[model samples]
Target: MKNQTTTTSVTTGQMFRFVFGQVLNRRWLLGLNVLALTVISLLEFVIPQYEQYIIDHVIPRRDLGLLTEVVLGLLGTAIALGVLNYLSTYYMGIMSQGAITNLRTELYQYTLRLDTHFFESSKTGDLMVRLTSDISNLQSLISANMLSMIGSIVTFIFVWIYIFIINWQMAVAVTLTFPLMFLIYRVFRTRIHNAFRAARASQAQMSNQMQNTLTQIDLIKSYTNEDLEENRFGAYAQTNKQDMINATQNQAIFSPLIDFVNYLGVAIILALGAYFVIRRQLTVGQLVAYLSYVAMLQGPIRAFTQILNQLQQSLVSYGRVMDILALKPAITNAPNPVNFPAIKQGVTLDHVSFTYPDSDVSENGPVLPAVTDITFTIPFGKTTALVGHSGSGKTTLTRLIDRLYDIDSGTIGFDSVPIKDIRLSSLRKNIAIVSQDVYIIDGSIQDNILYGRENATDDEVWQVAQMADIADFIHSLPDGLATQVGERGVKLSGGQKQRLSIARALLKNAQIVILDEATASLDNESEKAIQHALENLMKARTSLVIAHRLSTIHSADQIIVMDDGHLVEQGTHESLLKANGAYAKLYNAQFS
Candidate 1:
């Protein structure tokens, strides 16, 4: 089977364009955000006008009466500014939070829908960064952070307009230095982008290294390699440190350059205004107002520069995130797939064969089939046991049946219907597989059991717990079903975790069940107990089992014996024992 998953790399500009369209769905909220900021900006402009009135009119006339009015205007403006600021911040916050929430939720669901191969070629740490850190960085840009920047831009523009009206010549002289700010950004923009990108890469490596150590802590200690692991962690930390330093250094350079450019503007305005005042072209009150406007411009200019830095960081993050969003899953439902109500007959493998997918294959290199010409029929409501040594393609057969991986050249049919035509949801929902190693969620015993069916009644949960033979242990605990299982169910024994897994399956009540060496690793007592429970549960259901122990399959309806990649024998257990072939040899060797 051939499948293609294309991950087309996109640039930051393309990613930004995509994001703008995505957030447009919340256009009403975004519009309200703009309205609020506009009000705040107008109010900010009104306050500066009051400052100009006090300096130009009140002080020059020595008018005490205008002083009272000016003080009242300032007080009133301050109160209005507070309220407008709150409204502006609140609406933008809502819009930003809503945007990020939608993006994060969609990305999470998309990750879940991705096929097995995508994860095989990806790293958990990098994925985590996309979901957590990258999403968070984007969130800041969409919300309050963005609103603040917009307000700054409005301030810069409005203040410039008033300064021109107050003294055209001085306005031109002062703002001449504004182009210098652009030149400074041009010099360092690429450096900052590269620094942040490198920092993010280094962060992912550190996260991966940390995750590796935490997951394998026991092995590290058992091998007494604490010092080695510490050194490795130190190396990752050093790389991360250097990357952050580079990014921070660029940020540091950005702030000071912004300050120098803005202050230079102020100095130019002061010198020109003083000359104009002496030449009788500008009044003292007008000169004072000009100085005040220059000061106001300083905050917005610096703020906008900081926002530019944030924008660069946001663009880098979005570029990485879009790369994941653009990938197509290897396996997806076919157009007009057949949805089976139920499997009425049985599974049939007619001349089936498979080979593992090899991405590293070279021309003229050897290729090997994992299973070759393997053919069999599992009759409905019966157990077929696959008994073989490791790497004998036993588990591979079950995986193909479950559609975890597609076979190379084969017709795998459920009830004689080709599996490829079936709807994946319907197929997976009706089937369940219990592997040798069970993944137990860290939660209450009841929570783990109820995870199989969210809407299952507590009575239904208790019944399955009993059938799986885990009810007694759960009841003996003080917390009963509510007892915590710890991480990966570490609080429970291996046998306990296996039974808990069975309880989960029992809750799902799938029609087809595949047991992959479920009882192979347990003690004799645990094995006997779980096996008896499994036999009871397997009744009236289609069960395919891979057993490491020969005795476990003695009563299996049909026994399949495989050697290398070929099926060497197939018969009932006793008939296979009498054949004096591969199955007989394997059985005798195990017992003897």
Candidate 2:
């Protein structure tokens, strides 16, 4: 698990560029939307001119037939604009949604393929938030919001041309307010950016709390810390509320200010036009046309800034999504992958050494190395055990062999080729693991056993279940193998869950087996059944066992003892006990 509350930096312009770039590849869709929107913008420009013509020409001449014709023309064009706008928005929606879905799928797939080191160094909840909320933000930006901003910009450009054509002097006067408006918009943007960052930080904090709380709800209730947890949650929520308020205030303040600027700009335009009309420099109709054009331009102008604000949010989320997409898994298959037929061919670590990239005590603290110069071998069809104290690097050594992590130096090999050279799918296919913390989905007993290997027939499922000694109990159940195991197999006892996990491994029919504290969670009866299952599974396979209980690995063909990233002892259990070293001390301490 990663430490809480690490900050991410993503700017608005970068996000817009990334998202827009994604759209550039879809030339057909882009052409369709832009063309439709262009027609709509052209229609919008015509509406103001048509109104000006009706007032200046038809009304002055008092020709009712001309008046009726112009009214119908404007109505027809208005309807056409609406249709074009709908078409543009419709196609844009499809393109945006498709892009977002594609991006999200790739992001999700990349996250799953990342090495265990990345997962260990990152928070699950933060990743979850990125997958859900951040994706949603991007989706909105693409689908509806972004297209509207594009339309606004197009409309502003067309309206500005009309304003300039009517009277240059008046156009210049209205344009002057823009710089002050932009200055005020800049101030609003700064405040809103800070507010939004705070809002996202609070959200991240809240997500971490929820993930921890839900996972450990039983612990909270057992320790009577529910109230404490609630207090912590509420405190974070309060910060979220405050951040939202600040963002709302920062953005909301701009609306009235912009409106005031619009009002003042219009007032100045009309007053100047009135003086020109008195001086016979401009007519009533020309003044009215300029005023109408300015009014039309104001909305699109204000909308442009509002869209820019939303763009900032999308950019932040875009950065987060890009981060996950760009993260290369530390452990990946070689360019030309090797395929291993079976794991019984044995495995070897030739001078393997490993240290976590970001696992350090402090800035200048001594870095801990988890494995060092570890040269060892487990021969084919043999059961080998690893014995170590906590933090002695036992788990790290197992993970190294599994290639959940890559070794910093030397090589780990199976079938005479480095594990890294083997295709990831082929490598994992040959091994099965039964760990202390067994996981079962909320599914039928059969489904849990055959998870991912679900095509196994009824006979095959039952065959493995019997070997794991879970068939008899499953048969006794009213639903047999169809019995629904509740979330994470909570419906079953610890011993029962362990047996089910063993059955799963048996069903895999893998050539290598790893038992990581597999029987530690069980009672004697359950442990005996699991041991029986292990013996059956290991018959023709190589096996590596990590045992806390001393008697579990007593009959192992070999035992390797580890302490502080180094091998302290290796031999048969009896020989190690006779050696009276770290292995002997551990054995006596547990069994004495």
In order, candidate lDDTs are: 0.81, 0.81
Q: Write the per-residue lDDT of candidate 2 for residues 1-592, one digit (tens) a residue.
A: 2333344566666677777777777979988887787777777777777767887788889999998999999999999987887787788888987887777787888888887767777777788888888888887667755676676678778778767776778888999988878888888877777777678778878998999998888799999999999999999999999998988887788777888898999999889999999999877777887787787678777776766557556666676677776666667778899797565468898888899777757687778689889888988989999999978888888788778888889998886788888888887877888889898898999889997377899999989888887888998999998899988787899878887888888888787789888888788887876788778877778999998887989999999999999888999988988899999999889877
Give per-residue lDDT, candidate 2, residue 49: 72
Q: Compared with the true structure, what per-residue lDDT tens digits does model 1 show for residues 1-592? A: 2221222345556755666565688888777777777777777777756776787788889999889989898898889878877876787777677778888899999988877767776778778887889888877666665666677678779888988998888788777877888888878888887787777777878787788888788799999999998998899889989988998899898888888888788888878888988998987777776787787777776666777657667777787777677666756677888875476778999888888765556587867788999999998889999988899999889878878778788799988778888889888877878888898888899989887888999899999999998888988999998899998887999899988889888888888989999988898899998986687568789999999988888888999888887888899988987888888888789889
Task: Report RMSD (Å) for each prediction in the order shown.
Answer: 3.0, 2.4
Residue 367 accuracy (lDDT) in model 2: 82
Q: Each model's TM-score?
A: 0.91, 0.94
Give model 1's TM-score versus the native structure. Answer: 0.91
Model 1 regions lying over 4 Å from their true place: 1-26, 165-168, 295-299, 351-358, 362-369
